[model samples]
Target: MSASIAARNIAGVVLLGLGLAVGSTGAPAVAATTVHTGVATQLGPCPTPTEAPGTEPIPFPLTSSVKPTDTSTSTVIVPDGPQMQCSTTAPTLYEDITYSSPTTGGVETDLKLDLQIPDTPGDKPLVIYITGGGFITADKSANLGQRTYVADQGYAVASIEYRTQLTGATYEDGLADVKSAVRYLRAHADEYGIDASQVAVWGQSAGGYLAAMAGATNGIKRFDIGENLNQSSSVQAVVDEFGASDLAGMADDYDAATQTAYMAPGSFINNYVFGPGSTRTVATDARANRAANPATYLRRGVSAPVVMLHGDQDQIVSPSQTLTYLNALKAKGVEGTRYVVQGANHGDMSFLGDPDAGLLWSTQKVMDVITGFLDQKIGS
Candidate 1:
């Protein structure tokens, strides 16, 4: 079946399910699953600057500074596979590193992330990976091998879990989680021997949306939430793969008639932007929709360099999303690169290789492109 047809069928079924759910419960129900079982760490304030802003700089003699010692280790278990070729060595994996952030209700939620550090480490650059599931379901385990492969390449890789629509979380909540995770990692960079200034954020599908938001609003105050407020959540680079850059525009383009259908409230696209149980039109809330869009944050001096990968045949997020975002970046004089994978559908592994070769081959090919891009932008 063609990807577009498959996506439309899936959308119909999902809308039907949502309708039934609303009918039975009279409201959107939050999933009962508990996100975390432990108390979250409390981060302290940022250190005061030595000198006042706009003050004349003090002159000091240039001297050699000793680099911090490397004493960190990884615990990731490596399986023998073709993907192993991406990394020459195994990385130490630290699972379930928890960080706390507040939801719209101001209630604390414990967010978890998995960190994979290269066994052979200096002050390595870091990359935070966000998984794609249309903002409804996904976890740190979604792309374990790819993450480990990156870690093995002399970088620290972190896979994070953010609240989803099922948890009654909106796009804003998810974006906040991404920023908070960056802050948490920076706050403890010394413990892991990470070069905090060289951090990059990468994500796929829904995760890509969050990654784009993080990159565009690198220093924006509104998205900065949770602990470690003193720490800058700004990332130096971003890799967005098949993610939506503009929520309102994409929704209107995807299925304008269905987007306003009574059952469309249950659709993933609507729920992600408007929150669960929403009945308002996506275009109705222009300000909220614009705030959620990464394009809104793109400006001449405020955005980070971005590399975007999208499938021309993507059924969920159309290629126009990337084109529109790239155009905006260009207009603002922001640096960015876009690669449209031919004959590929939404999240299709075939874009990486021949369909007959299987996922392992395709994954390795994709990894090469990603690593090469990282090497140029942030230095792998």
Candidate 2:
């Protein structure tokens, strides 16, 4: 079945970028936005940057969409797959390093991680990449490609393994596993040539959800369980791309058609996080979603700098999910930046083999926006 249920021949789609500044409690909401709104026209080759890299800059102005305009009635088939990230020809620095081993219901599962170091020297900032597999499978081996790209930009990348519902683990348990990975890295920072202070959590889809959760609950003791209790799990940066912020609200964001498709079968968000029999959109007042909401734990002083990206055209995970999370965060007086990519779908689900879509969202220009945020906040 096709992931997207939205009409293909969309008209006058708006492509814009919003940079929000949300201050502490009792503060007002402020924003600095530069929007290039029109039918998507240009999408290829990174435009020449006027300023230096790693600054607060949206390197590529989103003017037009690479998505082809279909005049006649049309249906799109997005080949489902992992996110299309940078190349990873570089060898692994370390692999299969167990970060946590937690026994649940008298069963023990060893959670391991693989690290990728750059060919260039220096103790590098670390990016803990959480793999996305609908939360039923957390494979550290997938998306190993992004490691080399990040490392080449003077950062180290570590893909970690976390417990999924398939292992009878809850969402909280998965989050705890992420914290354990951070603490473990900090404990052995020097040994691994990492700068513990400069760490970021970057993930796609479900991984993005966990990444946001980690940042929202940074340094919170309850999530820190087993090994390296002395070290902190708080990260300096967070990158969440098309992750579900509100579980039930996610269904609410879907249109009638999309909801029908999403609730059809194999609904991971329902089965894994919200539980089975929840294969339906929920009302906004359903506070049950707050239970696992990362934004629910956001504190002004505690939460790290966050950079959120989403595809406006995504049907799997609506861009509104990002807004819901970020808006909730802003109301609490925290700060974050949101970049909405036009014509892109959730992760690579809709654009796996589509080169135009690939160039639109996963190019070096896009990576620069990400690495730039990391550099400004974490000094990688």
Considering every candidate listed, which one attains the maximal TM-score?
1
Residues 151-241, candidate 1, lDDT per residue (tens digit)?
Answer: 6677888888888777788888788888888888888888878998888998987888889999998888888767778888888888887
Model 1 root mean square deviation, Cα atoms: 17.1
- The CA lDDT at 132 in model 2 is 67
TM-score of each candidate structure, all chains considered together: 0.74, 0.72
| lDDT of model 2, residue 371 | 79
Per-residue lDDT over 89-138 for candidate 2, one digit per residue giving the tens place of the 0 to 100 score:
34335767777777655688877887876655678788999866656667
| TM-score: model 1 vs. ground truth | 0.74
Total clashing pairs in model 1: 4
The Cα error of candidate 2 at residue 114, in Å, is: 1.1
| Stretches > 4 Å off in candidate 2 | 1-92, 260-267, 274-285, 350-359
Give per-candidate clash totals: 4, 3
